[model samples]
Target: MTTNENKSENLIGFNRLNEHVVFDSKKEMNYAVADHLKSNAAFLRDNSKNILNYLAKIASHHNGACGVLYDTIAERLSITKRTVERCMSELKQNNIIEVVKQYSKRGGRMSSVIRILPFVTEKKAPVGEDVGYPVGNESGPEHPKKPSGSKSQSPSEKDTNLSNPLLSSYKQGTVVASLLYIFDDFRNKGLSRPKFEEIVKEAIPEAINLKAYVRSVCSNYVENKSKFTNRFKKHCV
Candidate 1:
């Protein structure tokens, strides 16, 4: 083959390889997000639709991002700039994504720095590694430790009312539905908040800390310390 022809063929081959790798990266990103939720079945249920949609969009657009602007996302999604900004804010608040200020050579406005998080799976103990202590032949790893104070409520108890209504304005039916779904997943895996929090950190790479959203149903419980404690006791066993 001619030298020029050989060079052309090599360039074509490199382009094909690059395309293949980029495609795999996108799939892996989406899968990582899904696996993060799977790891924390409880928190996943409570996530709003807006958050999920925003994530899905980011996954889809990661490949095309030389530098995308809010206007571009808003136009493509058929939503207003305010709505797009709101979703971005929520995603940032939740530690899902971070916005870095960047300038493009052809830019009018500054662009964001979009970084995808790494995938996190449970760490399995080595096949038969033994520590200084005896290894109990227990089935799986011991169940994850729960948070210190949160407990479950019985069926007959009534909910409390709150002085600060905003915090309590979380929708109960939605919260419960999300919680039930997540808790069932947690039960099957025998995991708890600390473990679940670790998984959430993996999903949201920029998130250094994790916090649950205040549920609307719990609004009444926020007024007085006594009322909050009583209501907390009533709902949770």
Candidate 2:
């Protein structure tokens, strides 16, 4: 082949490769968010997944962010606006998404800017691995060595998860729904959120896997509510 023809073919091949390749950060991150929620069956309930996926779909086209209107989301998802609000509350508490800004005009609320956060894990790095690089290491609930007391909020405050609420409930670095559910049960039972979360946190390290423990607690906590605490005390306390 002539040198000129060979050069043209090489350029064409490079161009063809470029046509199919994508390196957009927003697209990649939106995909990671979708995949994380999809694979982790126990990460969140289906309702949460629906709204998250919808937001993600919008965000993919809008540079990793999109405006949020609860009514619009409700209409599109075939759910009540209250349900959308409540699930968004849960997502906020779990650090799944963040609201960058809220808009208001004429003394009335308008649509808010929502930022989609990609799911992450808190796995311990291998020994001698570089720990200097920053990861999303949340200082989660600690062991219940000496429970520090805090002013308790009213029941409504606990339910609402207010930013300025009196009590500090738990938030996880990783999305573990059962842990949060058990904490919710404890909240209903009036067990102090911080203390109980810590107590449960300590026991987690000793378990081979949280699956059996979480399943037992979750099932017993529901099926045998009265005896749930005693069974849990035997294992976790």
Question: Runs in model 2 with CA error above 4 Å?
Answer: 1-24, 38-40, 103-110, 123-135, 138-237
TM-score of each: 0.31, 0.40
lDDT of 1 by residue, 78-114 (tens): 7788877776675454434444443333433332344
What value does the lDDT take at residue 71 in candidate 1? Answer: 65
- Number of colliding residue pairs in each model: 10, 0
lDDT of 2 at 215: 40
Candidate 2 worst ten-residue window by lDDT? 164-173
Clashing pairs in 1: 41-182, 42-182, 153-235, 161-220, 162-220, 163-223, 168-216, 168-219, 169-216, 170-216
Candidate 2 global TM-score: 0.40
Candidates in order have lDDT scores of: 0.38, 0.50
Per-residue C-alpha lDDT of model 2 across residues 1-237, encoded as one tens digit per residue: 334323422432432222212225666756767665765558677788888887776555444455546776787789999999888886665556765432222323333455565555544656754322113333333334423453343333232232321112222222232244344444555445455445455444333455456545554544565577678888884
Best by TM-score: 2
